[model samples]
Target: MNPKVKTGISAAQTGLKAVKIGKKALNLKKKLPGEKKKATQKALEKSAKKAAKQEQKTEKKQSCRQRNRRALKNTKGIGRIALAIWNRYF
Candidate 1:
């Protein structure tokens, strides 16, 4: 942003600052239409990667929980069949 417009924003409302913005502007190159498509494709790829990471994280957590549950059942003298029945009904 132009410095003149930056300071004049708050001062404009009070009518105490000189507004000299919009007089001079930088000419920027317009983006190609194909550039936008590529950007969106990149964004979607990023989302898919993030989802895969989250799925792996959840899978790891579930496996850890299962291991802990098995250890608990074993410590309590619960048989495999009993554990399976308890898990199915509960």
Candidate 2:
């Protein structure tokens, strides 16, 4: 695979590990007051929504990349044919 893609995968894995560790740390803490608990719940929900949006964005970008690749492939075939015709004439 591409080096950049590998690096991104590695970074994502590290981030996942950090999030897991953070959750564990949070669990170790003493119970928070009712208001604090509600605040934490809201924050977690917000973060979850943000992550979902990011995932959808990533998927859209990947689909666009695939479409661009397909377009380039089609153009490359036409380009080669044009080059052949030019070489034959000039």
Best by TM-score: 2
lDDT (C-alpha, whole model) for all candidates: 0.53, 0.71
Evaluate model 2: give its TM-score: 0.53
Model 1 clash pairs? none
TM-score of 1: 0.46
Q: Please give, for residues 4-82, the per-residue lDDT of candidate 2 as tens digits.
A: 6854775586578558755844663447877777777667657756765676577567767877998999999999999
Model 1 C-alpha lDDT per residue in residues 1-90, reported as the tens digit of each score: 553564455335323211211111111113336666566556655655565566557656766777798799787775767888999999
Q: Given candidate 2, what's the lDDT at residue 60?
A: 66
TM-score of each: 0.46, 0.53
Tell me model 1's lDDT, rounded to 2 decimals.
0.53
Q: After superposition, how far is residue 35 of candidate 2 from its true place, in Å?
A: 0.9
